[model samples]
Target: MEVNIEIPSHFLCPISLQLMRDPVTISTGITFDRDFIEKWLFSCNKTICPVTKQPLDDDLSFVITPNHTLRRLIQSWCTLHASYGVERIPTPTQPPTITHSNISKLISDASKSPQQLRYTCLQRIRSSIAPATTRYYSSRCKNIIVTCGGIQYVANVLIEKDATRREKEEAVFILAQMDGYDQEFKSVVLRNDDYADLFIDSLVGLLSSESSSNRERENAIKVMKMVYSVADPTRLGSVEHEMFAHIVRVLRDKVSKEATKNALKLVVELNPWGRNRVKAVGSGAVHVLVELLLDERLDRRISELALVVLDQLCGCAEGRADLVGHGAGLAVVSKKILRVSHVASDRAIRILSSISRYVGTAKVVGEMMEVGVVAKLCLVIQVDCSSKTKERAKEMLRLHSRVWKNSPCIPPHLISSYPTN
Candidate 1:
């Protein structure tokens, strides 16, 4: 016999609207499933209790006491309805505790004593950077770290003159991971001009440090990328020239594939500002991008990013000069069209269009013909490409067909596709 048992409305979590498992009570006396409430408080950063509408604690150290009574009642009800296919709820594991008081004491002692205890605390938190595969300790420790000024403490480790290089690297990596969890912490850190300056300076310094390992450079670039993700245009535009300089240096140095990719993205994001475009160009960004585009083994994503940056850089005269100055620049840009993804092809066309429209002197247009740029544009028209890309390609072809249509570089097969004068 099959029976559908109706779950009692009162036993449902207010947020999930599902039958409550491991119910827990917050200070507002409202009950919710443990997972749902924790997600609400920690993940969603909601300050108010869901049902009661009362403001919860600001520090995220507020306790969520397990409602053993309600949990047992739900379990018993599930058992009673077992015949109807309702499985009994197993005993839930106890939630991890956030010892705010203990963390605060540790931070205070570390600041005052500055000895073995501080190092030990840092080591413990440092080890907690592992992902929360199953052990919730890392997540719990991070919560404790943030609520008890442990985040600031960790950031301070980077600023500590006495801290070893390894210590600073570890601290930077830890804060970078923590940056993923809490937007509140990010906002708080960025709001303080002193902390934000120290944070950025620490990353830039570590990246450029002679003693900094490849791993350290990779981690620093990753953290800087994450920080830039949350920054507004004004803040992004206001970033220091040294920042842009080192970012280009990272790309130029090719510290690691991941670091290069991040630097490319950072360049793309920051180049919208006139000052940034000028600074990045002066930092030899256009030259590095042209070289990146010429890499035979470049990943599609990196290629796409490079072309996008190139497309932006070409907006300035110096950027265009650098692109044209490279022997392989026009050829590489032409090669990527229709060979990579749609975005890549679009950017490549845009780059060509920029040169043809703004910077195409007779020698430049002749180089375009020599490099098979005209042939690639003709190919774009014959293939299945986006309308916008095809239009741009056609535009580039028509703009220069008088000079390039009869060139020996154009394949006989693609000549018919080129627009007439």
Candidate 2:
């Protein structure tokens, strides 16, 4: 009885028992001393949430049914949490917000002003956000902001052409930014399949709202450039409209410049199955493109768009050939004697050569060769530097002779007619 036993003063921390209280862990990661822990437990009528009385049926069991002797050891720790807010302490490292207001404002203002003022407005917009704000891909808003930012930047830069050639193209750069943020946008796309369709239609509607100026084509050209830049060609073919006269207007007009070219570029990128819906834009696109090809005054952009649409028409093995084999196909050929200077249309050269390869499309080709497209092909073959253009031109000639064996090759100077019968 003379010998006395003493308990060790050291105890486990209420939060992470790896150490003692000097500090001890409570059920909610709070650290306290035995004294405070015991007091709080007693104050709360033992084994219950102090705040909500929800019952401390949680981890860090020391507080749940803390033995009075040990709980008293943690008593001091209870005051630390009640004084300091724990809910405010969340994991660090969050991302920034996406701000597209400036971009939208500038574009809206530019659309209403004179063309010269519009360029200046774009320059101001580009200078403000071009280099820094857009450098990294944003991970926050499911990439909707990224897509809009890209199309916005493209509106500013595409028309300028060399706008960012030295600094990294806004369009291409935005696309690359999206690549890093794919998971974000992909989720949006999965949730909303019609987003792309809605997006394009909205932009088209916005640009057309400009009533005073004919520069809408220029606006559409730049917008379409960006859209087609990332446009899923296979999915793009499904896009159609009843008011295609607007696009036809863009192609045939001298003011719009590259307007139709943008439209045609999207048309060519599509898979064959997709081409039918795009082709369904009625004969307005075809009629205007053909007529424009013959006019020397017609801008290269229009010619290029027409040629591309025509190429897609003639090159298709499906019902597109049916559209071409009849009067529509002949009408285009009867107009253009030679598309000598209009080389920008990828649709022109690609589809010309492509059309020659399809056996069923020969009726269209027969009309093609007779329309002076073959002689133009021959001229292009002699000197066209691009391996692609040259190769396709060569194929056009071969198909021309094979399909139109009886039709003599017409000299480049004269327009050739399809057999009227």
Best of the candidates, lDDT: 1
- The Cα local distance difference test for each model comes to 0.79, 0.46
**How many clashing residue pairs appear in each of the predictions shown?**
0, 23
Model 1 over residues 1-421: C-alpha lDDT tens digits? 1446788887999999988877888878888998788667644446688887776543222356789999889999988888888887889654444477756766786677564344545644664445542356677777878877787787778777787665687677777677555475576557667778777888889988888888788888887887777777767889877887888878888888988888888788788888888888888888888887778898999999999999998998888888888888898999998788989999999999999998889999998988878888888898888899899888888887788878899989887888775
Model 2 misplacement above 4 A: 1-198, 207-212, 231-237, 242-246, 252-255, 269-283, 299-302, 317-421
lDDT of 2 by residue, 120-185 (tens): 333333333333444442343324444444344433333343332322222333332343444443
State in Å the error of residue 44, model 1: 35
Query: Residue 158 of candidate 1: its Cα lDDT?
Result: 79
lDDT of 2 at 95: 23
After superposing candidate 1, which stretches have Cα over 4 Å from the reference? Answer: 1-109, 131-144
lDDT of 2 at 99: 46
Error of 1 at 21 (Å): 30
Report the CA-based lDDT of candidate 1 relative to the real structure: 0.79
